[model samples]
Target: MQADNVTRTFEDPMLLQRIPSAFLISAAVLVGMEVIGFLLLCEKHVYEITGFSVSESTWGEANEVPSKINDECAENAVMSNKEMTPLEALQTADFYLLWASVCCILVPQTMLSSLSKFFGLEYIRDDSFLAGITMASSVCNAVGRVIWGLLGDYLSFKVPLCCLLLVWTILLVTFPHLSGFEGSHLKALYSLWVCLMFFCLSGVFVFTPLASNALYGSRNMTINFGLVYSAFIIGGILAAVLTRIPQLHGQTFTQFTIGGMFCCVAFVLCLWLKDPKYPNKLKNLDVFFWFREYISLRCFHWSLGRYFRQCS
Candidate 1:
């Protein structure tokens, strides 16, 4: 056999370094101490879910079906199902609407996460507890990414994601009042609530890319999501401007309220996305139906399998 003297080049190379276990252990211990210190000093106050009685009326009016736009498919006319050219996708009204809603939703998270520890320390005069809240929120941020990614894969992304926004909106709207309460264990709730907010925010990071890939095509996912994600930069700038407000000026409430309203708006926009099944009609905007459909899908598969086994 002749000896060959050729070296293979890799198109993509990964760093082969391994993180030290000692460093990981030390970091974990430090973080655990920070969290424990926060919890130990945390004021015990009663937590209550204030405002809004849950009823059909509490959920707002039944969704109005938009008038069907004339499809009038011209012979060989390109449709949404066809892979969209980047320019064509950019020009569509839906994409920008989604972007605007995401930008609005992101502003609150950016501002709140940046200010959470400051807010807690200023109010309670406990540094450790507030630091703990910050750490918990960061951990939940990672948790939310994993959870929402799995959710998107198991259930199509749009509807359940919107429900999460609805829940997040409710939490944001009430957070200011609840956290500020003096005697109630509400302060503890505040920490948990902030973590949930971070959770929702992190999920959006996962969802936006998936949404872009589904709505446009995977071929364009990189550029399309990049354009959508630019909204985060815009959101961050808004957060920076918001910081100019004096802390005593009810700035926290103002920020949270704005975030809550934007989340609601995002939910509404999510309802408008055209369904793949019903070409003429818009997707059913019923939040309840979307919640139930996944369960129904699972049951249907189970039944079908049972029938096949019985036949065999």
Candidate 2:
């Protein structure tokens, strides 16, 4: 009788319930964690704590470099308080310039990272050493984000962005020659180059959002940053296309040289970028005007260096 009953239950069409048991458990866990987070995490306003908004703070005061504040104050003041709608930001030339710069900057990072192992095997044959190089590169990548972010805050975003691109350009162009070093020297140099490349590349992730925020206001930063970040799509496509080029295939020097050229283009774009505060500085795409301004800025930096040398 028991066996017959068991057989009848097994044969029953509706014996098993179509319950969403897994979905219910997952939903419950997600809700519980979210509730806990909501209760634990509290938002704090900088204005409430410091009795002043960040926009009201002067760069001179923040960085304690007041000597040149007079020259920069007007520009800084406008940039600090400037707010733009996402649509307005999208319509601006600065937006497209930044997008193009990011597109070019991403090329080396995408290509090098994808080809790291393959490239490293040409010099260092050991798989374990290559793995260590990757691990070291990752550590530098994390540390660099913080360092670059702080540097941007101190010196402004443009200077650091340009410097980072310049360094990456040099690294990419010269990286293929590391194979000349024999034995341990090759491995060490290769690792150093890879780590430094990663460190410099990390700034892109930090600076892009900060630049977007500085340009478009914090209120709609999400959308503005998202628009800027779309450059990665183009960058990835370019990297893929470059890798598939017949002349570039198995030609490390040519490949790196091409990547370096792209990086140099990004650096120039950064130079041409007008300060958000001084949008009227160069109107009608004035190349001569831009060149004059750049030269003057370089001279000013040189003068400052001389002054500091004399003081010391």
Model 1: per-residue Cα lDDT at residue 187? 66
Candidate 2 has which clashing residue pairs, if any? Answer: none
How does candidate 2 score on lDDT? 0.80
> What would the per-residue lDDT of candidate 2 be over residues 1-312, giving only the tens digit for each residue?
011222322333343343456578879999999999999998885663555556546754777765556655566666667788889998886798899999998788777786665677655667678778888998999999999988877665776887899999999999988878889988888988999999998998998888888778888899999999999999989899999989777788888888889999998887776555433332444463378577879999999999999999
Q: Could you tell me how far off, in angstroms, the CA of residue 190 lies in candidate 1 after the best superposition?
A: 1.6
Reference-based lDDT, residue 248, model 1: 27
Report the C-alpha lDDT of model 1 over 110-200, residue by residue, as the tens digit.
Answer: 6666555545654554546665778888899988899898887644467556768888888888877765565337567777778888888
lDDT: worst 10-residue window of model 1: 1-10
lDDT of each: 0.67, 0.80
Candidate 1 whole-model C-alpha lDDT, 0 to 1: 0.67
For every candidate in turn, the CA RMSD to the true structure comes to 23.2, 15.6
